[model samples]
Target: MQDLIAHAPVLFPLLLALGASAGFLAGLLGIGGGIVLVPGLYFLFKTLGYAEASLMHLAVGTSLAIIIPTGISSARAHYRKGAVRMDIVKMVGPGILLGVAAGTVIADHLSGAALTIVFAGALLLFAAMMQIPPKVRDEGHAMTPVKGSAGGFVIGGLSSLMGIGGATLNVPFMTLNGVPIHQAVGSSSALGPVIALPGTIGFILIGLGVPGLPPFSLGYINLLAVCVIAPLSVVAAPYGAALAHSVSVKTLRRVFSAFIIIVAVKMIWEASHG
Candidate 1:
């Protein structure tokens, strides 16, 4: 606690900046801001000389904790615009819950290096998919939904493991299935809490009694980081949603693709070297 207090000046500003950036991206892209938050938190903790064994877990946990409010704020903004598809949320909710539970278990057992690699790999795949333009289908027509709960389960599980809000995968999946881009983004924003809430609880439970956590931590979730980041992110989310409504879909895809690629590459390199 004393050490954290001593570093408050530096950490608080960084957390604020992170929250702002993450919230904007979440609203703008229908993402939960985990793609940005996980890596940022990892770097910050690493620099602070946190133990190698727990750093990535802490980062992932803290990111999910922050996403709860951030997701709500972004989802509400999109909902107000009539962009969210509650039907899809309802369809996938059960599968997402199961998958998140499975993912949290997987994450808890994995080493920090393994988890980092998984995050990087998933980001790389998402970035690649984003770079490809979605095929346009007949107006009001969408691809047949994949049968069963498998798709939702996979999405939810992958999201939990990566400590993301599932937007990176969900947006693309919905868009590819013939959902309108805006609707896809909006629905994905709504999915954030579905992924974060259970995932956060899982992490906290799994990490309880574990060693090497930073100060002010509850299980793997860092209270200090959550407190610092969540409010700023919530405040900034609406602006991003407004931007999403204003921007061209093509432009948003291109921008998000580029951003994810860079982050993915950086994480991959760091994992390899570390």
Candidate 2:
């Protein structure tokens, strides 16, 4: 623990940067910072000399911990904009909880490289989704309950494994299914804690009694990272939400596509090299 504390100076600055970056992106894209934070933490952990095999899992779990607050902050910001659908949140929330639990089990068994590859693939898929043509013919209706349930499971599973809040997937999916993009992004913001709560519990149970884990660890979740990042993330998230309101939708879509592409390329490079 002393050794970990000794490293605090190094980690704290990085966490602060991560929080700011996430906040800006969350505001800009209506997506949580998980996509940014998880992969970035993977490399940070690897550099810190933790076991390569556990690094990505730790990153994912810790990202979830940090995202808990950011998501809530962003969600509230969107709620104030009248973008959230209570009906959708009510219907999807339980399915997400169940799926997150299942995904945590899968994460526990997967290899680090396998997880990275999967993450890389997910990023690529997000990039593709962002680039695709819009499919919405109407902008005021929600999908059927069955579609919502299925989407919830997918979002929950991916979020649990990748440490994402599913905003990347959710926003695009909702837009395609006829929800307005603003509302989609807003509602998607709330998913972070929904995914995090069950996933964090699962990681704790799985990581208990493990040997050679990093200091300040809680199962796969890292307290050092979470504590360092969460507060700033909360503060910055509303700023990002406000920014979301300022951008034109076309400009926002272009920015979102470009951002995912850049991130996807970075992930592919890291996965290939690491």
Candidate 3:
């Protein structure tokens, strides 16, 4: 607590910046901020002097905690724009829940290098995905239950493994398949819980028997950071969504992509060096 207090001056601003960046990207691109948050937390925790072995877990867990609130706030913001597809969300929820559990278990076993490699791959893939323009299908609007479930599985697994809320993966899939941006964002927002709930639980279960875990850590999740950062993020998320209506998303996407690239680099650096 004393160490955290002394670092508050630096950590608070860092958290705010992270929250703001997350909101902006969520509003602009329909992503859940995990792409940025995970890598950022990795570096931040390292800076805070956490041990190497426990550092990535803390980063992943803490990232999940913050997503709990950020997801809700961002979802509401996009929902108000009538972009959410509730039916689609409902159809996919079951598969997503199960997949997240599976993914978390897989992640719990991987080393930090493996995790960093996965994150880097995701970032690169996302960058490529953005560049490839979506070609909306001219077919029927309704998606099949089987298809939705399959999509949910992918979203949940990737999100849990990467410690994301599946937004980054969700939005492009929807847009490419003919779903509108607003609906994609709203629906993806709801998916966060499906990912976070099981993922967080998985981390806890895995971390329980491990020795030398960080102080005040629950499995991998850090309650202190989550409690402090999530509230503001929740509030900020809606504001970002509302503001998105007026902003230029094209510009936002380009800048956001570059920002993600930087984070990827940092994570890779740490995984190799520390």
Indicate which candidate wins on lDDT. Answer: 1
The candidate 2 region of ten consecutive residues with least summed lDDT is: 133-142
Residue 85 of model 1 has an lDDT of: 86
**lDDT tens readout by residue for model 2, 1-274:** 8768877788778878887877777666655688778877886787778887787888888888787777777678778989898777776777788788888888888877888888878877776665575565464565777778888888899889888887877777777777776667777777667887778888878878766678989898888788877887777766776877776755776776677677667766776787
For model 1, residues 1-274, the per-residue Cα lDDT tens digits are 8879887888888989988998887668655688889988998888787788788888898988888887887789889999998877776677888999999999988988889889889888877776675553554655333421566789999989888988777777777666788888888888889999999999999889988778899998999999988998888877987988778866887887887788888877877788
Candidate 1 wrongly placed segments (more than 4 Å): 28-30, 135-148, 240-260
Indicate the TM-score of model 3: 0.86
Candidate 3, residue 9: Cα displacement in angstroms equals: 3.8
lDDT over C-alpha atoms for residue 263 of model 1: 80
Question: What is the Å distance of residue 224 in model 3 from its true position?
Answer: 1.5
Q: Output the better candidate (1/3) by lDDT.
A: 1
Rank candidates, lDDT, best first. 1, 2, 3
Preferred candidate (TM-score higher): 1 or 3: 1
In order, candidate lDDTs are: 0.83, 0.77, 0.73
Q: Candidate 1 clashing pairs?
A: none
Q: Candidate 1 vs. truth: CA RMSD?
A: 2.8
Supply the global lDDT for candidate 1: 0.83
